[model samples]
Target: MIAALYWSMNIPGQVAMREGLEAQVKIINEQAQQTNARGIKLIPRIAGDGAEGIEKQIQQMYEMVALRPDAIVIQPTDNAALAKPLRAANRAKIPVIAYDQYIDDGELAAYISSDNFQAGVMGGEYVAAHFDNQKPIRLILVEYPHVSSTVERVNGFLDALSGNQQKYQILKTYEAVEPISGQRAGERILADFPQKDSVDVVFTVNDGGGLNVVEALAKAGRNEIFVATIDGDPKSVENIRKNRLTRIDSAQFCGPLGAEAIKAAYNVLRDQPTPRYALIPTFPITRETLSLYPGWAGPIPQDFKKPWSSLEPMWRGQSRVVIP
Candidate 1:
């Protein structure tokens, strides 16, 4: 049997990201079965929310290394600490594959992630399109550190506005501990923003953050500011459906990514050399394209109904843990 370890930076429990990773795990297992290859088994490890100091995460990485699974597919907590585990895996002859997040290491093979930079550009373009022209636009950006995906996204967004800085002025940048903290930060930002309608746009790194910004703006009795974000979570999909705001998602394809990583590990097991990276291109998702896009929306099965439960904050403006 080909054994692999999977770790996500989304803490021990958060239904949305957890469900996505679980779905990815399921798909990888099924793909392994269909191929008649020794199925890849995933051993899951949690790394908190990437905010509660790095010591625990570092310890977890070492534990995962000690177990020495056939391979490890990881979304790193701290990009720097990732190198130690990955190097240990390498020394032990276990392949490492990364998805959604990248760690700086030369020996590791393969990364399957959406083009985060392009997604950011799409967000900027969406906001620009709303204005019909690039005018003096004031905006707020909420982001986090160590998640290369998020950083790449911000780079892409800024690149999209190259030579267009005059058109968009970033009023402030707030760093959140996690996506849930983003909501609280959004609420605080609302109070600080000028009462005048000067702020025209809000760009967040993910749907969780964007939705928080939306909630805060709504609470402040403010609308009309174009909100854009990454991550095609169900709430973002519902917002698109209702035309609440425009979103440029990276079409979070967790299954395909995990499956590809598993396939690569199988190749490694077979003593075959594989490529160093798998660049999954970004797929833009707007309201008109939601139906064609599958698996990006949350709350899983379409047969279920909860009357806005899909869009309602699963985190409920506060962060907590719910393990499965």
Candidate 2:
């Protein structure tokens, strides 16, 4: 019987991560069905957006690792804080695959994720080029913590703005990951940094948070500012199409990468060769290509149909999708 442990942060709040996890779970289960192996059992977990919440989640992961499953797949709540669990898994000789978040501890079997730094650079450069030499550029920054991608994206954005900071000063940075909460945070920040007829741009690390900022700006009748974000979920892509958001980088293939990580784990177990890291490209999504996505591409709640334990046989090549 083959088993796996998969951890994902609170899906109810972060749509992009939630959707990515759900899609991977779906593919993993389907693959298991074909393999006729004991299904890939996933131990589900989530961490919210605060220090206390993250601490609790890390403790839970440590406890779960004691069960000693075949592999542990995770989008860690905090890569730095979760080192203890990875170390434990390493001692137990258990293979671990981290998705979306990279663990530099060198204990994991492999890491899979999008190139968020490049996405951020593109976003920053796009905005900088668009608003060249602008005056009184009031900027609002919406940020989230814990996730490595979030931190990297912000870093890349700032890096691109190097030597071009005077024309665009950040007025305020808001916090919150959930769209509604993010919107409220944006509103509060807006009230404090109200355009003053000089605000020119708004930036968010992820699309869900960006949407909240856009909603707050719309309600306040502040449409003159350029908004940019990472993750081209349907809504954000739509915003770009409608001209509400200035740019969108769709690091949208995370789900597929997660699914592949499981396959990589299986290959490792079977003594087959596989890459230590899988890099998924993040391309910009504009109004011209927004229609290509499914209607549920945005911040929709995850509704996974099956559990990981029931999907084992599919991975052995039975009940699998046949490619042309």
Candidate 3:
């Protein structure tokens, strides 16, 4: 059997995404070596991200389908763009395992991803804790609209804040999941909110350009603006420890997430039972809880008493969403 692994836009900004893809590829090779049989052969594809990314990703998907690999595992870039080709793959009777994000339309043998929404909620919870709820918070959001995981994380973060009845006004919204845009966003934040306390909080959807934004704030001596971000890049964690503008960061279990996809695909090929969807949990690394987390290459630490995780059943009733 042969399978193709497709990672949507594996670019420099997304450290965890690249790491996850690498981990997935590594697991596949290891499995093949262990069996020493005619095991599944792998082909890897990455959409060179830029203005032409969607087009490139679409073309890559169609090409993968044409190869007629035994199965395909893809991390979808755009929710709706991949539908047609995915349906084509379905018609060709190829099983697909989607990781990180799901397509708007497709039949997948299995889908696995981090509990992105929960990660966002953790960020929101952190913000909620800092404020007394008497005053409105001025929030700056850094986002990436193309990917489902980023969208879900933003939604989850907002939901947690609103659900907690915390008052906040969105001061500005910027788009950056990579360095250039991220750096531009940082410069813009400084320019727009030159006055201290002009921006109370900055919530970055991921660590891609997020660390850059944090650095920009720190360099400009803008320590008053509280920062919260997702993706447990080691740099982000170190910043938190050093008492930078960033107060909290949610870390994705990237390695485990990728490994799960391969494991699911392996099961699908054998005609075994596979869950329709899997939500691997994400860990929030804050100063108070940083010791518990071991970074991305992790034995994702157990929960400590936090506002969100402390609720009955943990992670507010989604605790069962852990690595299988």
Candidate 4:
């Protein structure tokens, strides 16, 4: 058996997560070798950056399908853009698994990803609790609108804040797709609101952008602004521990997510029943609880308490397998 794993981009944090996925694939192959079962070949390709990168991704998918790999797993660069090529794979009778980011419209054997919406909800809940009875929250949201996962996170964050409109006033929104873009966005925000206490809180979809925001604020000596973000990147985790700026980061259990994705692919290839969608868990890590966090590329903290415990029952019901 053979499978092609197509990654959207080769960013630092994503690279760390990809390593975990690759490790699991190796383990699966090793087990097959020992048991004399059919071993799987894992092929990897990374889409570079921006529009050109998306085009490359589409072309790669078309090429992979032509090669007739048994299965293909992809983290699409864009939600809707990759539909055509993915549909082509469907027509080829090749199983396609959507990993990390989802294809908004396509025939997918399985969809594996973190509970991104819940991650944002965790961020929002943390922010609300921090400012429970305090003055109105002057919030600025930095988001990447291109990807479905980030969009869902932003929507979930907004949903959590909807109940307290009076308490949390949305000041503005900026699109920061990556770290450099986020830095530029941060500079713009600082230029617009020159005062030290201009914005009370900032919510960035990912830690890459959030770190840039932190840098921009720190450079301007605006340590007063509170930040909430997703992606428990090592740098972000360190910042959370050292600097008082970052409040909470909803960590995705990427290692478990990758292992589950491979398992789903294996099941699909074997003509076994697999859930259409599998959502890996996410938990919030704060400065106070940093000691318990097991890092972003995670073996989930055994003793750590899940921030979204109430939603666990529903999550367990939806997920095909329970993750530790």
lDDT of each: 0.61, 0.62, 0.78, 0.77
Q: Write the residue-wise lDDT of candidate 3 on 199-221 in tens digits.
A: 99999987777988998989999
The TM-score-based order of candidates, best leading, equals 4, 3, 1, 2
TM-score of each: 0.78, 0.77, 0.90, 0.90
Candidate 1 residue runs with Cα over 4 Å from true position: 1-37, 132-134, 163-166, 194-196, 297-324
Model 3 reaches what TM-score against the true structure? Answer: 0.90
**lDDT (10s digit) by residue, model 1, range 1-324:** 333334444422133444555565576668768998655566766655544545565666677777877777666666776787678777887677776677776366666566677667666655555563446678788787667888988887766665233377789888753557777877777778848586777777876566767777766766666777777766766777776744445455444455555555566666776655655444456764566566642222222221111121121111111111
**Which of the numbered candidates is closest to the native, going by highest lDDT?**
3
Candidate 3 segments whose C-alpha is farther than 4 A from its true place: 1-38, 307-324
- State how far residue 45 of model 4 sits from its true place (Å): 1.0
Question: How many residue pairs clash in model 2?
Answer: 17
19 in model 4: Cα distance from truth in Å?
0.9
State the lDDT of candidate 4 residue by residue for 1-324, as single tens digits. 455555544455566557666777888889989999776778777876678778889898898899999999777888888999888998999889877888877689888888888888878767776675346789999998888889989988877666434277889999876677778888988988898888989999987677788888888888899999898877778778887588888877766777777777887887788888878777677876677777766666554444432333222213434222
Ranking by lDDT: 3, 4, 2, 1
The TM-score, computed over Cα atoms with residue i paired to residue i, of candidate 1 is 0.78
lDDT of 3 at 73: 81
- Global Cα RMSD, each model: 9.0, 9.7, 2.9, 3.2
